[model samples]
Target: MTTRNIVHLDADRVYWTTEVTYDRFPARQLWALAAPIHELVIPARLRHAAGASRPGDLQHQLVTTFQRRLGNPVLSRLPGQTLLETTGRSSGLPRQTPIGGRRVGQEFWLVSEFGERSQYVRNIQADPRVRLRLHGRWLRGVAHLLPDDDARARLKSLPRLNSTAVQAFGTDLLTIRIDLD
Candidate 1:
């Protein structure tokens, strides 16, 4: 299993985590794990932090300030909005793929191609408890979700899989979300 380290930033602090077995995993599943958490926490965390001023508001402020100044930078460090990783399941090695393409603008928006048969997609459908990590010049954040409706909608809106990109490796393209982060 391949282990890929990722970073996440929330309203409070940053975190670092590893996505084990990424190379063998599929992209769709990775998105499913990440999309909902990104959609709900990111915005709420930002808003909660914005008005912070005192000790009680420090957590909110931290989240807000980080989102305002470091959100994009942190996101840019992600391998991609969608990622594949391996995990330990009762049946030997099970792949834990998280999908959800992200776009970084004034805020980060996540997208995905739903209904695609992939390990990452299936993982999300079966279980939404996933973790994310963000590494930065000086800080990092780790995030996860218990599962929620807001995340489901965000996943549903992901762009369809289509398009192509020609790079040094030659012609390579797949249905992916465009994320500025």
Candidate 2:
């Protein structure tokens, strides 16, 4: 058995590969049956993850819980999903949170569904320096929590489907602007 992780630095892609060899006939037979099931189950769990799909339809506590558990991890790994990476306030570690946003000029804009109460929000407050994975490329930036910015109006400027989801499920909407360097 062998595994390979191919990282294309230029393309910013990670390819997960595994090769399994069964020596015995029974082992091969068992694996043949399991392989098909494996194919179906893996992608299914990934899809079940709110991050892989979208959790916009879910409500407050549910949204937060589901997203924290099932959203960010899968979403952050998606090919083109945007990820916000911040320094953990107390732990002093990098924390990546999947977010919905759009880039305008050199700035990346997003609305926080949880406002200042979100963990990432508090992280931003502690330290504004951050990284954003946009369309597969990592960009260094500084995060700004815009309290006065009209979040609803800001949503209108973002992607329609995501903005609609944010409008539908958001309780405390706050605008966040990341000035990219």
List lDDT for all candidates, in order. Answer: 0.38, 0.81
- List residue ranges in candidate 2 displaced over 4 A: 1-59
Across 58-164, the per-residue lDDT of candidate 2 in tens digits comes to 34556776677667778877988989999999999999998899999999999998788789999999999999999889999999999999999999999987899
Over all chains combined, what TM-score does candidate 1 have?
A: 0.24
Q: In each prediction, how many residue pairs overlap at the backbone (N, C-alpha, C within less than 3 A)?
A: 41, 1
Over the stretch 96-145, how does candidate 1's per-residue lDDT look in tens digits? 33333443442223322222232333443454333332121211111222
Q: What's the CA error at residue 155 for candidate 2, in Å?
A: 0.3
On lDDT, the candidate that comes out on top is 2
Residue 42, model 2: Cα distance from true site in angstroms? 32
Clashing pairs in 2: 51-71
**Lowest lDDT 10-residue stretch of candidate 2:** 1-10
Best by TM-score: 2
Per-prediction TM-score, please? 0.24, 0.67
